[model samples]
Target: MEKFTKISGIAAPMPMINIDTDMIIPKQFLKTIKRSGLGVNLFDEMRYDGDGNEIPDFVLNKPAYRDAEILIAGDNFGCGSSREHAPWAIKDFGIRCVIAPSFADIFYNNCFKNGILPIALPQEQVDILMNEAQKGANARIEVDLEAQTVTTSEGEVISFEVDAFKKHCLLEGLDDIGLTMEKVQAINAFEAGVGATRPWV
Candidate 1:
């Protein structure tokens, strides 16, 4: 996973609540295990019409938000099934952070694992960011994981909380496998000793 330290980019406003996993990438697209290429299908139903043409009114379909790296979503974001593909699709779309008043527990944790920051802020603060995001490409939001702050284009700063351990992992680009790799030398030594003592096996 890529390290997520600080980022400044377009912020897309998605105010709809209860955005489940299916709405994100859709159940039809869940056939693949690979994470890449899912970005094209992100928010499939909302972004496309019955003929699969891009909808003009959708936030992501709009030119300004096409490259948005952050999402200011409504409450209960990432609800429903615990498929890890949701975060994969978001990250693949170049969205490094998701800011909402609240998020489903499983999805929230999965974000960190996939190099995405799922921020939980008060509704008032999220609304403020949402307004800023409405300004199209003219407005850019900055996120600092170390400082735990999200700064709007107008210079308004809002702080959110994150677990310290997870923060360290993201900063260091350490996923579950990366974490274990940190102790590779010790693991190798222990394996060697076991082989020496149990050579008969």
Candidate 2:
């Protein structure tokens, strides 16, 4: 996973609530275990028509939001199934942060594991960011995981809360495997001792 210290980029406004994991990447796309290449299918149903043509009105389909690295969404974001692919799709799409009034517990935790910052802010604050994101590419939003702040293009700063341990993991680019690798030397030593003692087996 990539380190997420700070992100300053375009924010796409997605005001619809209850955006479930299926709506993010769809069930059909979940067959593969690989995390890469899901970005093209992110919000697949919403971004394409039955014919697979890009829908003009979808926020992500719009030219201004095509490269958005942050998302300002409505309440209950990432609700439904606990599939980890949701965050993978979001991250693969280059969205480093998702700001919403609230998020599903499993999905929220999964975001941290996948190097995506899922921010739960008050409704009022989310609304403010949503409006700012509507200004298109020119309006850049900055998210600082270290400072726990989201600054709007107009210079308005809103502070958010994140678990200290999660923050550290993201800052250091440490996923579960990465965390385990940190103790590789100790693990190797223990394995060697076990091999010596249990050689008969």
Best by TM-score: 1
Question: lDDT tens digits, residues 1-201, model 1?
Answer: 799999999999999999999899899989999989999999999999999999999999999999999999999999999989999999999999999999999999999999999999999999999999999899999999999999998999898899999999999989999999999999999999989999876
Cα error of candidate 2 at position 49, Å = 0.5
Q: In candidate 2, what are the lDDT values of residues 1-201, reduced to their tens digit?
A: 899999899999999999998999899999999998999999999999999999999999999999999999999999999999999999999999999999999999999999999999999999999999999998999999999999998999999999999999999999999999999999999999989999775
As a whole number from 0 to 100, the lDDT of residue 187 in candidate 1 is: 100
Clashing pairs in 1: none
User: TM-scores across all candidates?
Assistant: 0.98, 0.97
Residue 178, candidate 1: C-alpha displacement in angstroms? 0.8
Q: Weakest 10 consecutive residues, lDDT, candidate 1?
A: 192-201
Judge candidate 2 against the unseen true structure and give its global Cα lDDT, from 0 to 1.
0.95
Question: Which whole-number lDDT from 0 to 100 does residue 122 have in model 2?
Answer: 96
C-alpha RMSD values across all candidates: 0.9, 1.0
Model 2 Cα shift for residue 199 (angstroms): 3.3
Error of 1 at 94 (Å): 0.8
Q: lDDT for each of the candidates?
A: 0.94, 0.95
